[model samples]
Target chain A: MKLLQQTILEKGTVLPNGVLKVNTFLNHQIDTGLMIEIGKEFAERFTDSNINKVITIESSGIAPSFFAAHTLDVPLIFARKKKSLTLKDNVYTSQVFSFTKQETSEITVAKEFLAENDRVLIIDDFLANGQAAQGLIDVVKQAGASVAGIGIVIEKTFQPGRQILEDKGYRVESLARVQSLQDGQITFLQEQISVTN
Target chain B: MKLLQQTILEKGTVLPNGVLKVNTFLNHQIDTGLMIEIGKEFAERFTDSNINKVITIESSGIAPSFFAAHTLDVPLIFARKKKSLTLKDNVYTSQVFSFTKQETSEITVAKEFLAENDRVLIIDDFLANGQAAQGLIDVVKQAGASVAGIGIVIEKTFQPGRQILEDKGYRVESLARVQSLQDGQITFLQEQISVTN
Candidate 1:
């Protein structure tokens, strides 16, 4: 967690209008070593959750989630944004609105992958408004499965995503919680008290 | 390699129209233990290539490529299919035609991540007609980087992907060289000689 928070401060770019660009290390150009550490952290955090599966949205969430699933010795499933030819029918679908792209896309998981008895751990790179995480949770619910926990790499605490999921009684664990990204400066939740003091 | 080939035979599904679905392990629902093996195999195969970076397309390609980059102790960069708000300008872009979706999408890699002196290894989930692979290669070339090699999880040997890449002089190492998916039987290239004899 220290490494992640440090890397975020060192390499992350704070864009206008509450956008944090971590593409240099977290999403686009990935730091595998950091991801391994992140995976270990998530696995350790949810060690007692009895998570049987790790689910995430495609594109960005696969790396950290895959490593977490690897460390936990579980299968990692990514919900697809678009229905491919191979992924036809028998799917649990949910709609996710992306504030970054300003679009809503259907995210789906094959029904064959999730079951009623499975305990799912949802992971993602960024938790802005929690639309993506909610979508994944919806898909898991459609299969009659239970969500054990939510693992987020970087969370925007100023956003309502964490509160929304917590209100629904999901245990949300985020590696780096950004309290504010104002004036091209990033303030983590933990650092907030000290900064204000 | 044996593990990957065995996985393909045991879990892979053959659908109509040259679609070999291994979503059970390779892409959708990922087996991380197997991916570790794949990373090790790819690292061993390209041990002498001096690869400084591992690159791939996003979504399906992230998992295997992440492990490969981890094993090789290099950074992994996934080209984005769509430009998000955070990823604006200063990018190297290429058009990729997806046979599965029957659509063309522009894949972009941030210019800062790639360098002119970088030696890259391109990894992908599947190499069917080599369109995706070609698109990745084009992006790397745009960065003025050299592709050290190409690693694929599965290769449709019956297709022209391998031949097209080989003709272009890129060293392609596919764990499972699928000879044919005819009659719903998954055949590897190594098994072809014996199957014919």
Candidate 2:
């Protein structure tokens, strides 16, 4: 988490809006070494949660979640942004509104992937408004699975995403927590506190 | 690769419209163990190509590409399906038509991530009509980067993808070369031949 925070401070760009552009390493472009470390961090955090599967949304969420699933030695399931032609019927679908894209898209997972006895750990790249996380949680509920925890690479603490999920009683662990991005400066929450501590 | 072929034969579903759905293990839900082996296989195949980066399209491609990049100790970049709000300018863009989706979308990558001297290895989940692979190759070309090779998890040899890439003089390595899916049977091009051989 310290490495992630430092990477964000070094390579991340603050857009005009509240967006933090990490295309260099996290979003558009990925650092596999950092991602593997992030996955190990998540596994170390939630190792005793009895997680059977790791679920995330398509595109950006796939990389970190895949590594997490690998470290956890479980299967990784990514909810499709839209239902493709081959993915017809018998799917647990949820409508998610993306604050960034400013559009609503349905995320879906095949019902055969999740079951009542499964414990799922949800992972994603960013958690701003938490719509995507909520959608994955909804899909897990539809399959009668239990939510183990949520692993986030970067979280905007200024946003309501963390509060919303915490209010819902879901444990959320974020690697980089940005307290503010005002005046083109990145401010992390509790910068002095070590992640390992 | 043998494990991958066995997984395809056991779990891959051939849809009515010539689409083979391997969502059980490759697309939707991923087996991390298998994917790790896939990354190693790709690393072994392209070990001498001098690849500094591994590129892939989003969603399903991220998993295998992530592992490949990890094994190769390089960065992984996934082209965005569309230009997002954060990814505004200075991008290498290419148009890709998804035969299965029945729609065309533009893929974009940040210009800074790729360079003229970069040797990139492109990886993808499926090689059907080779449109996605072509789009990635175009992006790499636009950045003046040379493509080291292309690695595909499943290649439908019955389709024109493999032939097209081969005709263009690109080195393509497919883990499973599916010959036919007629009559709901998953047939490989050479079932008896070992991938290691």
Q: Which candidate is the best by lDDT?
A: 2
CAPRI quality level assigned to candidate 2 from its DockQ score: high
The digit string of per-residue lDDT tens for model 1 on A69-169 reads 98899999999998888887889999999998899999989999999999999999999899999999999999999999999999999999999999999
By how many angstroms RMSD does model 2 differ from the true structure? 2.5
lDDT of 1 by residue, B83-185 (tens): 7777779999999998888999999999999999999999999998999999999999998999999999988888899899999999999888888888988
- Contacts from the true interface found in each model, as a fraction, amount to 0.96, 0.97
lDDT of 1 at A197: 44
Best by DockQ: 2
Q: List the residue pairs that clash in candidate 2.
A: none
Tell me candidate 2's TM-score on chain B: 0.96
**Residue A108 error, candidate 2, Å:** 0.8
Which digits, one per residue and each the tens of the lDDT, describe model 2 over residues B10-107? 99989988899999888899898898899999999999999999999987898877778988999999999988999878999999999999999999
Clashes of 1: 0
Clashes of each: 0, 0
